[model samples]
Target: MKSKYYIITIVNVITMTIICFYFYEQNKLIEVTTNNDTRPIELLKKIVIDSNDKSAYNELRDAYLNEQYHEEVLFYSLLMANITHYRQAYFDFYYLLKYADRSQEMKIFDNETRLLMIEYLKKGAALKHEQSMHELGDLYMEGKYVPKDTILGKKLINSIGL
Candidate 1:
């Protein structure tokens, strides 16, 4: 009877220790995450590698968005487009739209990336950027940004005339 009691006590203590350790580790992770460090990007990379970690994915995406990491935003957007096509990818797509450099534009690609490209062109047009107007006209002419509507493309090109 004494041995049974001792074994039960040991098991109870071991279980409590494990639970406490888990909480402690979890709390530590929270602390690390809250700190303004680039480690969150690393964590995001890990979550990308393990698609099963949905919570981690959300956290990492939020962190990257907050940090304004354009490349990371583009990557996650494309990844989501490829895997799930979730609406959140649109938010990342918008981020990329606002920040992507012109030199990097060629790399911004996916089946659904046209929507983002069109948004960028519109933004440029709104800002009166002649280059964007020309690009948009060309894309329209070539059926890149939208279905080829030669009439509309010619109209845009003639309006821009460049």
Candidate 2:
């Protein structure tokens, strides 16, 4: 109930922010403050006061996202993935891990992080997360990380009608 409103409010705020940015870009007279620190601290305090506040947590995650705090985003995203067990959360993890830096030894991620990413994806897929299945399947098909199994990739993708 409350969460739905929070989501809508967040969406509205994001949409306005985007519109403001576009206008600011063209006019060069207005200054956009996407990097404002006021929001994160307030949200953090709210979270500290009540750790179970999902709305605060969600807003804090979005704040981290807006601030481009990758590790913080990843941490909250991992928690969300574990807590919600939803396709969107798993997709967040997948999207972050996909863009993570690789080692000079041709590793997609550091060994532990890579394994963790794979483990999360596998669990998400087993739980029938559509995005997880699609991304894991894509990984298999790409043959970049882990063993390449086109058959398995196709199977996973096809399982989701992708």
lDDT of each: 0.54, 0.60
Clashing pairs in 1: none
- Put down candidate 1 lDDT per residue, 44-150, tens digits, no spaces: 65676467354555666677556544455455554554365444553444445535534474654443344544654555554555555565667778986478877
- TM value for model 2: 0.55
**CA error at residue 88 for candidate 2, angstroms:** 3.2
Candidate 1 Cα deviation (angstroms), residue 121: 13
Please give the TM-score that candidate 1 achieves against the real structure: 0.37
For lDDT, the strongest prediction is 2
The list of candidate 2 runs beyond 4 A from truth reads 1-41, 44-59, 83-87, 102-108
Q: What is the lDDT of candidate 2?
A: 0.60
Please give the clash total of every predicted structure, in order.
Answer: 0, 0
lDDT of 2 by residue, 1-162 (tens): 989756754554354335434543454322223244455444553463346454555565566566555445455555566566654556666566555554234544455455556766787788888888888899899985669999999999999996
